[model samples]
Target: MTKIHTLSCDIETHSSTDLAKSGVYRYCEAEDFEVLLFGYSVDGREAQVVDLANGEQMPRETLDALNDVRVEKWAFNAAFERICLSRFLGLSTGTYLDPASWRCTMVWSEYLGLPLSLMGVGAVLGLEKQKLSEGKDLIRYFCTPCNPTIANGG
Candidate 1:
């Protein structure tokens, strides 16, 4: 069997800018933008979630893998991961990681006439595990911008 060196990753981020309006570049430029969690699986191993929001550091090996061109990086929406990581890694403001090393499953799904949502993809592929419907609420509360108030810390 051929061995594969790949990382499948997803990141949850918080930004004061509206991602739906400003797009990733501008959204990430927000001073308050931060990666809350980074979820990844390496070579099909059990997935891990790094709680960056709580000051957790990513493993050195995983960090290296992200920088290594030889290691493929896969994600449902690879561009977002790549861009967010590029910012996190302190790359120059206008620079981003090379797109050649990344793969986007969202593009593949669209090519295959599947919906652009994880739930839709799960339903279309008849996968046993589906993305939780409740995730939307959590994302709204944490990942998107909210009214800055004393109670929630904004």
Candidate 2:
């Protein structure tokens, strides 16, 4: 019997998805959506980042594992990753990665009465590493429609 491999992934994306307005499915379904960066770790290995924005492709084996239900896939809010990646993989909007193979750290956080953000969980759990403080500013700058003001250099 083959031992199961656990793969954890995190992604940064751009979409018209007003996540607060539309739910995850609709958010992930935005026509302009595209994954920019992909961070991942397999087994017990140190994580690696793939600059999808720079046109890097995931390794064939990693792609195979993502499509393989036998291996476990995990993320902070895994449903978003699963649905978004389905689109990235050209599986169409309604199609999805199997729920049976996906795990959500956010769900687990809610279940444990912990905060449901990477930063929150890290602080609460006293993690040595945490989400970047500048990430939100960066997201606002690039992930949304920006004002064509002089400051923005439109």
Candidate 3:
């Protein structure tokens, strides 16, 4: 029997002090931007996280797994991951795996005309209750620039 390939991933980002002004783009280009997190799983199990804030890096084994053609790296927005990995590893991402090899959950969701958000899909599938009741508020807080204390600079 053929063994299933593992999925590898990494997430790069910059956190914004203000979500409103920053918007989603802020995560892509924050001044202090860096690869904030890394995730990987084998056949969708044993998911792991590496927090770059703590100076964590992928183990040599994980890096070896990435070079295995049998493994398929997964990501939400793969381009970000690819670019971030390229910069972090000091090697062109092309050397490890073709960009086409990575599977994007976000793209799959959109193909079904479902909400593009990971949280939205989870809710629709009844897999889990929405984690954030005030998603918009939280996104605004963490992602977007903060609205003026008073509207219109009251």
Candidate 4:
């Protein structure tokens, strides 16, 4: 089968919730923020997870697709993936993946009167692959910094 020039991406990043409320612009600027996990699909293929913290390199095809202006990128909240990837890719501030090439499922969900979260949307749509239930907890534990307690080994 011929592969389509469409890439779907999701990223887990570290940033202060306080700062992120303003916008992704400020969120990307956070001193400690970094991409920990990256989930992606290319040409509508099966999704794959890249553990960025574990030194996994993105496949060459995916990397090329990311920079290729022709590839259409998508995500539940496309802005977060696009913005975080921009930082991870070392693009300058105010400059990231072109929005024209990206699509946001969140916006589409809202348009259709569906919930904003991936899980909520999936549940409502009865998708077989629902978003993981422990995602929020995992995110809070791994993506956010604790109070720096000795017990937690911070």
Which candidate should be chosen as best, given lDDT against the real structure?
A: 1
> Which has the better TM-score: candidate 1, or candidate 3?
1
lDDT of 1 at 135: 91
lDDT of the candidates, in the order given: 0.91, 0.86, 0.62, 0.84
TM-score quality measure for candidate 4: 0.88
lDDT string, candidate 4, 36-115, tens digits? 88899887789999998899988877877887778898899888888888888899888897788888989999999999
lDDT of 3 by residue, 75-122 (tens): 876765755565555564244245666778788889999888767887
Model 2, CA-based lDDT: 0.86
Model 2: residues >4 Å from true position, as ranges?
A: 1-4, 149-154
In model 3, residue pairs whose N, Cα or C atoms come closer than 3 Å (at least 3 residues apart or on different chains), thus clashing, are: 18-144, 18-145, 19-143, 19-144, 19-145, 20-144, 20-145, 21-145, 22-145
Candidate 2 at 115: error in angstroms? 0.8
Count of clashing residue pairs in every prediction? 0, 0, 9, 0
Off by over 4 Å in 4: 1-4, 16-20, 149-154
Of the two candidates 1 and 4, the one with more favorable lDDT, higher being better, is: 1
What lDDT tens digits, residue by residue, belong to model 1 across residues 1-154? Answer: 3344999999999999999999999999999989999999999999999999999999888988889888899999899999999999888789988899999999999999999998899988999988988998999888887666954775
Model 3 ranges with Cα > 4 A deviation:
1-4, 8-12, 15-32, 67-69, 92-97, 129-154
TM-score for each predicted model, relative to the true structure: 0.92, 0.90, 0.64, 0.88
